[model samples]
Target: MSEENLRAAADAVLSRLVGDAGGTARLRVDQWRAVEALVVERRRTLVVQRTGWGKSAVYFVATALLRERGSGPTVIVSPLLALMRNQIDAAERAGIRARTINSANPEEWEAVRLEVASGEVDVLLVSPERLNNPDFRDGVLPELAATTGLLVVDEAHCISDWGHDFRPDYRRLRTMLADLPPGVPVLATTATANARVTADVAEQLGTGGDTPDALVLRGPLERESLSLGVLRLPDAAHRLAWLDGHLNELPGSGIVYTLTVAAAEEVAAFLRQRGHAVAAYTGRTENADREAAEADLLDNRVKALVATSALGMGFDKPDLGFVVHLGSPSSPIAYYQQVGRAGRGVEHADVLLLPGPEDEAIWRYFASLAFPAEEQVRRTLEVLAASDRPLSLPALEPLVELRRSRLETMLKVLDVDGAVRRVRGGWVATGAPWSYDRERYDWVARQREAEQRAMKEYAATAECRMEFLRRQLDDEGAAPCGRCDNCAGPRFTPEVDPAALEAARGELGRPGVEVEPRRMWPTGLPSVGLELKGRIPPGEQAAPGRALGRLSDIGWGNRLRPLLEQGAPDGRVPDDVADAVVAVLADWAKGPGGWASGRPEAPARPVGVVTVASRTRPLLVRSLGERIAAVGRIPLLGTVEYSDDAVDARVPRSNSAQRLRALHGALTVPGTLAEAIAGGGPVLLVDDFTETGWTLAVAARLLRRAGAEAVMPLVLAVRG
Candidate 1:
C-alpha cells in the first residue's frame, strides 16, 4: 500500500473510533506515522508519547487497516485488568472486534480462542502473565505467533528490568518476538520510560531479524493539563485531614493513592466517615468490588478511590480531575506514570504529593524483598534439575526456602533465561547453563537507589515539578512548564479545617487491630525439619488476639514502625505505647468479640500473663508484659525461654517452612511457668511484634500443652 492510502485508511478508522465527538476525528502527524510504519512498511516501531496522545489509537487504527488487507488478528500484550477493559471498549468504538483472555474472564477463554482461530476477532488482549501460562504458552501462543498480524506490547517499559515497574513475566516477550514470522509488524508503547529503558525495549523489539531495526518515536514527556505540587505533611493524620478538607474543592472525581493496602482501606474508611463517597481499591480488593469502584469513579458517583499501586497503569478516565498521594512513591518514573492517570482529557487537573516521614521506611521494607542471594538461586536450580518431571509451585515450595511470590519471580526470570521451562503440570529444568548476572543485578539495585533519591528530590525541588519529573526520564526537551506550584506560586493552600483535623486525629489515634491466629500450618513444614502439617489442634491453638496496629497501617504504623524496626536499640516500652496497649485491652474487653462480652463462643478472661522471651528486644517484650499484668492485676507467669542454640539461631526471612523450622523447638515453657499456668484461665501472651506468627504459635502451643485452658496472643504491631 502507498503512504497516501495508509494515511487515508488510518483517518477513516480514527473517524469511526471517535464516533461524532468532533465529527470524524483525524490522526495527528505522529499517529499517522506510527500507523504507516505498522501497516505500510510492516516494520517494528516503539512509540513513547505522553498520555492521551493517541498511542492506543495508533494500534487500533493499524489493526483496522491490516484486517481490511486480509491480515491476521492483532495480539496485544496488556499489563493490567483495568487497561484491558479500557482497550476492549475502545476497540469496539473503532468497529474492531476485540476479546480478552485474562484471569477475570476465564469462562470466555474458549469462545475467545475459537473466535480468534476462526478469524472472527480483529484483536485479542492478553496479560503478560498469560504468556507464561502452561496451556496458552505451549498450545495457543505458538499458533497465535505464527499468524498474528501486528503484535502490540502496551506499557512496554515493563520489558526492561531497569524500568520503574519491571514485571518478570514480560521478559517472555523476547522469545515471542524472536519467534514471530517475517513481515509481522510489532509495536511497543509506553508513556513513561527513561533513555535506558527505551533503548532496552527497542533492542528487544528488533530481535529475530524480522525487523533488523525499529523506528523509535519519542515525544516530549510533559502533561500541560496537570498543575503539580508537593505538600510535606507532618504525619498521616494531617494528610488525611488535608484531604478531608480539600478533596471536594478539587476539579472533579479523582484518585487518592496510598503506598500500602492497609493505608488505602484506612483512608477510604476515614473519607466515608467524613461523608465522602469513596471506595478502597487495592490488590486485596475483590474483583467485583474493583469493577464497581472503577465504574463509580467513571460515572462520577464517587469523589475518589483510595487506592494502592494496584490502581496504576491502563485505567482510562480521560477527564479524571485530580490525583493526591498520601505518601510519595519511591521512584520519579513511577510517580509520573501514576499522576499521568489524571488530566489526560481535562484541560486542568490537580496533582498533589503529601510526603510523610514514613515513606523511606516503606521503601526500605520493599527493597528487602528484591532478588534473592546467589546461593538461594543456585539451590532452586539444583532442585529443579534433580527432578525428573515438572514440579508444581507447592511441590517446589517444600524443596526451596523462598516464599511463594519471590519463588515465582525467580522462576519467571529462569524461564526467560532458558534455564527452566513452564510445562503442562508445572515447571521443569531445561538443562541450559545459566549464570547469575551479579553485576547486572547490582546495577539494577543501584538504579533503584538512584530512583529513590530522585523521588526525594522531586518532593523537595523548588523548580517546576513537571520539569523535574521529565528530567528524571532523561527527556531532552524537559523545561519549566510555568504552570506548577513553584512557577505559578502556591496554587493550593496548606491550611486545613480544625474540626476535620481533630476528627482525623481521633480516627487515627484510636487504634485496635485484630490479629487472627494462624490455624493451618504452612504446607511442607515437615520437609524443613518441622514435624508439622495441616490444621493446628483446636485445644493447642491460640484464640483470636489483638494488636495496637499493623506495621503497614497508616494510623499507628508511623509510630510503631520505628520502635519495632530491626536494629533499634532495645529498651523499656514507651509510656505512651503502654497506655495505647491498655486502651486496646479496654476496647477488647467491651468489643463484640471480647471475652468479657459474655458470648458463649468467647474465651475466658486471662487469669495470668505469659511473656515470650525475645532474644533481640528482651527489654521491650518483658516490660510490655509486666505492664499488662500489673494493670490487669493478674499473676505474672514466668516467660517461655528460648533454648541456648535457638537464642542465637539465624532464621530465614524467605519462606514459611524455614521460619517454622527455626521456631519448632525454639520456645520451651519453664517448669515454674508451667506450674503457674496450670488449671488457669486463658493466658495473655505478650510479644513486641508479630512477623510470621510462628513465634506466637510455638509459644502458645507450649503454654497449652503446659495446662493453660487457652492462650490469647497480644502484640504491639503485626507486620504485613
Candidate 2:
C-alpha cells in the first residue's frame, strides 16, 4: 500500500472511531483493507468477521472518507430497530450525520428523505423491509440508489435462503444493487455464514452481471472470552429449576433464551417470583415494551432478559456477561450468532445450553412453516394474474387455503422474485415468466435436515463445543478451544435446590390459559359464498373459555403434544391430563367470568356437557367429555354430530375465512341435543383442540340458537 493512502486511512479511523474518547486509534490490518477497498478502490467487499470485530467501524470510517472525497452520502440497509438505534448513536459519536427511516418513526421518513436528497445527511440507515414499500421503492429508493456513494448490507447472511436466518426482505436488496450507478462501492457484512451462504450472497451482489464479485474477507470465529458447555436435563421442570437456583451464580446480567414465547414469559415470571429481576422479550411483545426491556438490560437494572430470536442480530451490548439457552437452536450457525452476544467486551462470560428431549419436536414445529408447495404457489399466481385490479391480502384469503402469516410470507418471496409486485393498495401479478424452483427448494429442505442433525450431534458430542460450531460455519482455522467444558472440565453442575425444584413443579402444575373468543367475522367472507360480515351477533358469540395449556407451552405441552399429535391413535385421555382438566375446571368456577363465579353477573353453573363430535380422535374426545361430565355430575348431552352427508373441510392450517366457510353449515345440532339445551343453564362445549376458533364459534352459535343460555367452550390444547 502507498504511504499516502495508508496515512489517509489511519486518519479516517482516528477521526471517526477515536474522536474525543481520549484514546489512540489504530486500524486492524483487515479493517484497513476493507476500508481501502471501499473508499480508495470503490470495489465491492464482504466482511465475514466475528462479532465485536469492528464491522461497524469499517463502515463508519469508510463513510467518513467517502464523504470527505465529495461522494454522495452512504446508504446502509440495516436489519433491526435495535441495530439502527445503535448505529445512529455511534454515527453521532463519530461526527457523521445519520438519519434513519424505519417502522418505529414513520413520521420522520419524509423529513429524512428530504435531507438525504438535499445532501445534508452524511449517512442514511434503512431497514430491509422498507426497500419494497411501494412509496419508498418507487420514489425515495431510486434517487438514493442513483446518488449513494457507498452501499452497505448489514447481516448479509440473511440475503441467502441457505443462511440460518433467511429473510425475504433481505433479498430485495438485489434490486437496489442493480440500480446503483457504476463504481458505487458496496459492503456486505455478517458474522454467521457458511461457505454456501457466502457464495450465494456474493453471486447476488453481482446481479447486474458487469461488476466483479464482492471480495470476501473471513476471520477466525473463535471467541477467546467464552466458556461453552451443554447440560442435559431430564425435563422442562428440572431445567427451570436449574435456572431458578443458579441464575445469580452466572457472571453478570445477560440473556436467557427460550424456544417459544410462552416459555419466555413463564420463565421471566417465575424468576421474578423467586426474587430475581427479569423481563421477557418476544416478537409478540409491544414495541414500547420491547424497547423498555432492551434498555433495562443495557443498564443492568435486571438480572437477565428472557427472550427468543427477536433479541438477535446487531444488538450492541459490548459488556454482556452471559448467555443461556433453555433449548438448543436448530442450527449451530444460529447458535453461534446468539452466544456471540456474550463475551464481546467482558473478560469472561459463561455460555450454556440446556438441551431437552423436546428440542427436536419444537424444531419440527417451526420448520413445518417452510416454503409453500408448488401447487399453492401456482394457485396464487393464477389468482393474481386473472384479477383485473390489484387484490389485497384479505381478498386473496378466501380464495387461497393458506393461513394469513404463511400467505404473507409466500407473497413477499414472490415479490422479491419478480413474479408479483406490491403496490399501494394490494399485490398484483407482474406478468413475468416464473417457474417453481422445485429442485432448489428441495435442496434447501435437505440442507435444513442436515443442520438439524448437526445440532443434535453438537448437543451429544463430548468434543470442544466452540470448535464444533466454528467447523459448522466452515471456518478453516477451526481448532479445539481449551476453554469449553469438554476441553477442560464441566463448569456447571446439573443439580438444583429442592426448593427451586418444588417451585418449578408448582408453576408447571398450574394450568388454564384463557381462550378469547372471536368477535368480528373475517373480512371478505362474502367472496367465498358466505354472507357473514361485521361483528358476530352478541347472543350467538361464545363466551371466554379455558384451555389446559397451549401446545407450544413448555410445561403441560410436554405431556399433551404426544397425545394430541396428528394421527396419534384414538386412546383415552392420559391420567395426568385428566387431572389437569379437573384442576382447570375447579379454578375456572370461582374465577372471574366463570359460570359459577359468585358475582350476580356470572352465569349459572354449566347445566350439561356437550361434546363436539370429532371425525378424528373421537375416542379421546368422547372419553374426556364423558369423564368431565361424570366428575361434575352433569348430564351427558347428545353429541353435536356432523350429519352423515356434511362436507367437513377441517384443515388444521387455514385462514379464518376458509375455516369459517368450512364450518358454516356443515355441523348441525341434533334434535336430542336441542331438547337437552332447552333445559340448560349454560352449555359446556368441549373439543379436542382449537386452531382458528371458527369451529367453536360455529358450534356455539348452533347451541345459542337451540336456546342455551350461553356456550362456554373448553379444549385440551390451543394452537397459537
Compared with the true structure, what per-residue lDDT tens digits does model 2 show for residues 1-720?
A: 575776565565555555635445777889888988998788899999999998999999889888878899999999998899888889988888999999999999989988998999998999998998999999989899889999999999999999989989898998899899999999999999999999999898877878987888989988999999999988889999999999999988999999889888988999999999999999889989988998998999999999999998878888899999998899999999999999898889999999877788888877888898999899999999999999999999988888888998899999998999999889999999998999999999999999999999999899989999999999998999999999998999999999999999999878888888989999999988999999999999999999999888788888788888877888888878888998899999989867678898988899899999898899889989988999999988978888677787586688888888888788999998899898568978999989899889999999999999999999999885
Across 15-96, the per-residue lDDT of candidate 1 in tens digits comes to 8887755546778889988988898889999999988888999999999999989999999999999998999899999899
- C-alpha TM-scores of all predictions: 0.98, 0.98
Structure candidate 1, residue pairs in collision: none
Candidate 1 stretches greater than 4 Å from native:
21-23, 647-652
- Which segments of candidate 2 are over 4 A away from where they belong? 1-20
* 10 residues in a row with least lDDT, candidate 2: 15-24
Judging by lDDT against the true structure, name the best candidate: 1
What TM-score does candidate 1 reach? 0.98
How accurate locally, in lDDT, is each candidate?
Answer: 0.90, 0.90
Model 1: how far is 274 from its true place, Å? 0.7
